[model samples]
Target: MGRVNTGPSDPTAPDHHEQGNPVTERVVAELVERSNTLGSDPRNTNFAGGNTSAAGTRTDPVTGGPVELLWVKGSGGDLGTLTEDGLAVLRLDRLRALVDVYPGEDREDEMVAAFDHCLFGKGGAAPSIDTAMHGLVRAAHVDHLHPDSGIALATAADGERLTRECFGDRVVWVPWRRPGFQLGLDIARIAEENPGAIGAVLGGHGITTWGATSQECQDHSLEVIRTAERFIAEHGRPEPFGPALEGYEPLPEEERRARAAALAPTVRGLASTDRAQVGHFTDTEEILDFLARAEHPRLAALGTSCPDHFLRTKVRPLVLDLPATAPLEQVVERLGELHVRYREDYRRYYEEHADADSPPMRGADPAVVLVPGVGMFTFGKDAKTARVAGEFYVNAVNVMRGAEALSTYRPIDESEKFRIEYWSLEEAKLRRQPAPKSLATRVAFVTGGASGIGRAVAERLAGEGACVVVADLDAEQAEKAAAEIGSADTAVGVACDVSDARAVTRALEQAALAFGGVDLVVNNAGLSISKPLLETTERDWDLQHDVMAKGSFLVSREAARMMTTQGMGGDIVYIASKNAVFAGPKNIAYSSVKADQAHQVRLLAAELGEHGIRVNGVNPDGVVRGSGIFAGGWGAQRAAVYGVEEKDLGAFYAKRTILGREVLPEHVANAVHVLTSGELSHTTGLLVPVDGGVAAAFLR
Candidate 1:
């Protein structure tokens, strides 16, 4: 058996963490431990839905001066098995100072300032919505998540009443607010209101808890949720109702486009002036109800997104008018009448609720206009805004219909809507400096390009208007993939063992000569050995490392030199594996070499980043339909070691993924594009796991 490396013996029985208190260590440990329950947590019924974070000051190994706001859980990460660094670091004091400013004075400028300060030095991930919220908590540990049980309670009628009954004396409740800086500030106010309050629940939102320790906070989260669930069972369900007009169908593209365009100007004039903002269009409820009974039952019930989305969608669109322009003044007059009724109803709602505060609301402008003959138009400030608005409306429609099956759909109240609409934190999030898509005119050379992820990335780059060269050890296969992609520059297939210096050099020359110059390079050709470490010889280690590790270096070095000479920056990508972090039994050499491969990318990044060249790696776990890496029929050997019949091989891998689906070559290719494209301009020296939550368990 291979011995796992143990660290050096302690000179004395000193604390493992010099800076943390015993209690702090215990809290962090418990939080870390409880969080491990995330993937398997009954609360996350969907594959990846929950999140977590931590905040504290620590002596930096390099800078040592009380580094603040060390790390927080990021988007697309499961808090369950997360480690310290998995959370991105942001300066808390800097963020808190940002929140204190009167953001409303110049919303956009202040918001962007927050993004610049909070996410400036972050890596692969961006700062999540809860960043400012965590900043306000100012606790050593903080955790957040959208728990189903809590949502179920928050979504019910009289949620506040029920909430008061359950933890009336325990958790403080903040009215609904859009997540981000506004929500953070709201939570801070609640925290201030109740000095010793352990946690707070955002109405129609979710629950948040903070403690000096991770475990305390985590336990608090669980307890608060359980309390809400108990509160609901005792209080009664919302009134039952039937869904309104549910039949719907997606329109033909030509018709849809024309309709959207015709209605576009109307929506823009009524809302924000962003034409790229398109709205969700659907037939009248009467027509939809008729469609529900059609043979295409599945296609008939398409609906919108969630309840809060009503703010963007209005209660529903008036599906009248055709070919769209009914004079702006006349349209405005009719819309004005409807707006008056909406305002009256809203005012009455607040007046009836004795405990609520009253404020003049932004007039209800129909965000989405459905012109029968034309289609639907969405209003927003930009393309992103339009898309989000459309999606939200769709989600709202869906939630409304779904809840009708059981009861009323829950919508966040006016206070929450107002808070989010003008939320400084959200504005800050929008200010995030987007990654540049600079590879538009660049050239890329990829190895193992005949098929699988290599081919996919090449095709994606080519699609994005880049000149790509598809190279492989197998010239025939490479040429085949090149032809499939049909690049005008034509991806030339050159045969060469990436491991051989002479072969790599020749391939580089051919690729450079064909493309004129190379700006992007993917060292994707690699292999894996499944033998145990004891069985893994010096030769096995040398062979795997040479191609996966050293081959990467040789290719990067040549690409770097070309980019330098051309006076343009470049990028280098690597195809790594999940085994790098979680080495499966018996594959010792493959794992160690893969780990070193990651290190190599980081090292290259540090060296080349100064030259305007970015180097990064893609670590994919269980890439099905990938290249020959797992081919050649190893079923017999795998069966022998696994002690199962060859037929069980599929199940073995399937059971390992949290998503219950195999990773695809296309998935890996997407990550490659994101990193190589301008979308992640400042991103470098990063390792991305394209495995759907596999590393969560591995690192745990």
Candidate 2:
């Protein structure tokens, strides 16, 4: 027997039982624990890819009677973090009966409807498509996983023979079949025939194991993995030589990031049809090692190791020979041509295998992109999805590598891949997803986003479907802010003191690399130095100008250059202040710089207008809440200067405005969104006042 590596040891002792509903609770807990065990390792599962189930009992909501239930992981639920609610309960008997009534033709639509009808309760979630297979097995617990170890064997040219040799008669081997009612029926028949079999290895799919309890099921699954590992260890071929690159040295971190930034817009544009897509570049050792191999092209062309991966990674990746020093324009043009070719090839593949009954297929866009000298870039409708796809492809690389080491790697035929790719059931998952936000395809780069108006703008942009880069002088705070604004692939944090041109350039590069270029730039980073002209030293004036005036200029210049290179119009909104128009006593340092920055915006608008760039400014007063400067004692000091109590300062500013409303960071953010969203497309080089109708600060 092979030993399993169960990962880090838990200091706490394991609990054997749960506190509620004895059997149901215990089963659910076991399912969760074991699923987490498998899922904690990406080599086992990616995102919400794999599934598990347990047989239990539930009261039928309609009949108010007991019903045999199969609780299976539902759609869009991650196994690693699964909960009771994530597992949908369905009538086991009803699910099994569907197999007998399932028509010979593709009945995915009917099967899904039947599954919905067989729910044990009114609001019960939809069960996995493999729910029937779980019901057919005699065991009380079952798990179907896409672990890399098992897939390495499963995708081999003679996987069945290898599996039989590895496990003797303990495991059953089933040929490739579409996952649905038919596959469920086949699994049941195979289990019945192979009595005492611990699991079934499905060709080009994954492994399924079952037992009386979750522990037994987990043990069997691990045992199968160990067996495959041992088999590969014994029969593996010599490692292939890597491609020769005479003078190729990995680019420095800064240069690599810059290259990614320049390449992102092109990748996003090529991947997009109606809207832009998010792009993520991953350069893990596994990806780099795989790409370095001489035989990478042949192995990568073999398709995904499993059928389920088709939905996330597509059938094949788009391979590019991107030299580190390639010109951005040339790279864009080359990718455009390759994209057209990729689409044409996909159409041909679809037509060759798609039957008249098949549902309309999605556009032929490559999800996984491979750049020989750079890294692997994955594209998705959003950042989270792109990250998920990238992770899956990385796992695929490991699996393929192992399979090749053992023998010739093979995957399901193109016809089978086509069925799963275009399956109504698979496509329904995407269809059922709620529509993305209006700014879904756009990316925004916000400076000083750790707090204040910058943070508000970041949150607002993410809410509207734009991925964001939260740039701040404090790296730790920036990352924390990014975490708070988390919406999977939506935001990333980068340390940037906007005063430094190098830091400003890197921040923009990071944004481009994270989300495939910048469509929106919020130049909101600034500092307030409250002092009389006599008290304000040369240091104070330089610091204020560096951030407010020079910083804004540098960031805007870099962003506009990227936008122009992409040939896509973009928006740059300068977060100026009411101080820009109305000077405050002892605030010359802040007021003078703000005034300079406002004119800089107009100058940029004039110069960049020819390149389809829109530059505008928003001037707001008295946004104390969550304002960094205010929180740093400026609020109290300002109140003292105005001869008002600190507690009454907010009210004072509110009543000072004609609208009698407190100006807020969100209000300023709203104004920025309006200009960036093209609601004011015809308007630019104008100042919008967000100071609660302040007459002195009003734009005429």
Best-performing candidate as measured by TM-score: 2
Q: For residues 567-604, could you state the per-residue lDDT of candidate 2 as single tens digits?
A: 66788999998888986788888899999988988898
TM-score of each: 0.40, 0.91
Candidate 1 local accuracy as lDDT? 0.58
Q: Compared with the true structure, what per-residue lDDT tens digits does model 1 show for residues 1-700?
A: 1111112111222323324656335434554565666535645212233456555444445655544543566654556556554556666556666754635533533453465565425363556656666666646566665555555445555556555667875787777655656666677767766867778766665577777656677777888867755554455334222222222342454554443433333343344222112222334443233233222122112222222344445444433321223454565466445445544654554455423332333344445544432334454432334444544444343333333323344565544454544344534444564642345446688887777778888888777656678878788888878888874343567776888887886776665434445678988887766788689889888988888788887888777776665445678988887777885788888788888878888898999888788888888875545546655444445556778765665456667778666677788888998898877889899888877768453543
Task: Write down the lDDT of every candidate, Cα atoms only.
Answer: 0.58, 0.78
| Model 1 residue 55 CA deviation in Å | 3.6
Error of 1 at 627 (Å): 14
Maximum-lDDT candidate: 2
User: What TM-score does model 1 achieve against the real structure?
Assistant: 0.40
